[model samples]
Target: MKKIFICFALCLLAAFFKPASAQFSTNENIKDQPKWGLAGQKYVEYYYLPDIDTYYYVPGKQFIYQSGGYWTFSSRLSKANRSYDLRGGNKVVINEPGAYRYFAEHKSKYGSSSSNVAVQKSQTDKNIKRQDSEKTSG
Candidate 1:
């Protein structure tokens, strides 16, 4: 009876404890990011394009936009945004997960006007430029 009770307790403890590998699940996306996109020390999860009210996921490399009143994910932007230049366009870095969930707040804060939007250079872009300058100077 004592041996059976000990075995049962051990099994219960094993069931309650998760594997060490599972603790790092949140960073699983980091492994799949493009080399250039991972240049900086900071990890960027998404980019909010206020100009068109779209969100770009860096890890999955997918564009999140509104279509038919629902959030749509696609690798390419719609035809209407084909002319938009991502490099030069205004971008707001959103490190939060599921950034689209706060669409109303983002829209209100960063309206259609460029002047109202607080544009920021992505960390990856900044680091790349820094490395390029260093190579030329060194």
Candidate 2:
């Protein structure tokens, strides 16, 4: 009976910690994102390329660009935009799945701001803060 009770307690403990472990992993994923993606974002559905006026669907790994007045989705950029470097362009992470549908209205909205640089600065600040806290605590 004591062994069964101990086993039950261990099972309860594992169940309680499972969700916390998953949450921690999700946070790590967000912190390790690429430059083309938002610095601290997970599950980015799309990346809006303001310079070339194109959208990169993250989940599908496809590029959404306007071709001949119609939206064309492809795994690679069209021949015309092949020269446009993906890394050099400013990208906005859109978490919504159908974010491209409203691109026409919001395209100019993000164009006016230099948010890419701002996000990088914010991420740096977070790292500094975390280091300072750890130093003081430890």
Candidate 3:
């Protein structure tokens, strides 16, 4: 009985004790990110496009936008937004789940006209440049 109990405990520990690297690995999550996602980031769940007030779900590859006071999901943006440059526009990395639920908050924080938007864009740009330099130097 003692040996059996000890074996069971050992098995439980082995199952729950994941390696540190494995626990922190973002490779699997990063695979779902969009092509224009931020470089050197571990993983991103959504990209909030402040300029257009839209959220792009990375895993689902869907755009979440407002239409007639309702949240809509589509693979592409509406005709009105067709002229927007998604790749060139400022993108705020949002890791929160169901980010659209806080649309009002996001808008106030990262909206096109918000002062925070410029600061965030500049910070993001600096990080990207730093990462690029590190990659090249290494």
TM-score of each: 0.55, 0.57, 0.62
Q: Pick the candidate with the highest TM-score.
A: 3
Question: Candidate 2: where are CA atoms >4 Å away?
Answer: 1-35, 115-138
Ten contiguous residues with the weakest lDDT in model 2: 129-138
Between 1 and 2, whose lDDT is larger? 1
How would you encode candidate 1's per-residue C-alpha lDDT over 5-94 as one tens digit per residue? 999999999989976675444534556554433234245677677788888888889989999988899998876897876665656556
Clashing pairs in 2: none
lDDT of 1: 0.65
Ranking by lDDT: 3, 1, 2
Give me the candidate number with maximum lDDT: 3
State the local distance difference test value for candidate 3. Answer: 0.69
**Candidate 2 vs 3: which has more TM-score:** 3
Model 2 agreement with the true structure over 1-138: per-residue lDDT tens digits:
999999999999888784434434442344334445644454456777777788877667788988999899998888888987666556766555476797875486666544442211132224311110111110
lDDT, each prediction: 0.65, 0.62, 0.69
Off by over 4 Å in 3: 1-28, 113-138
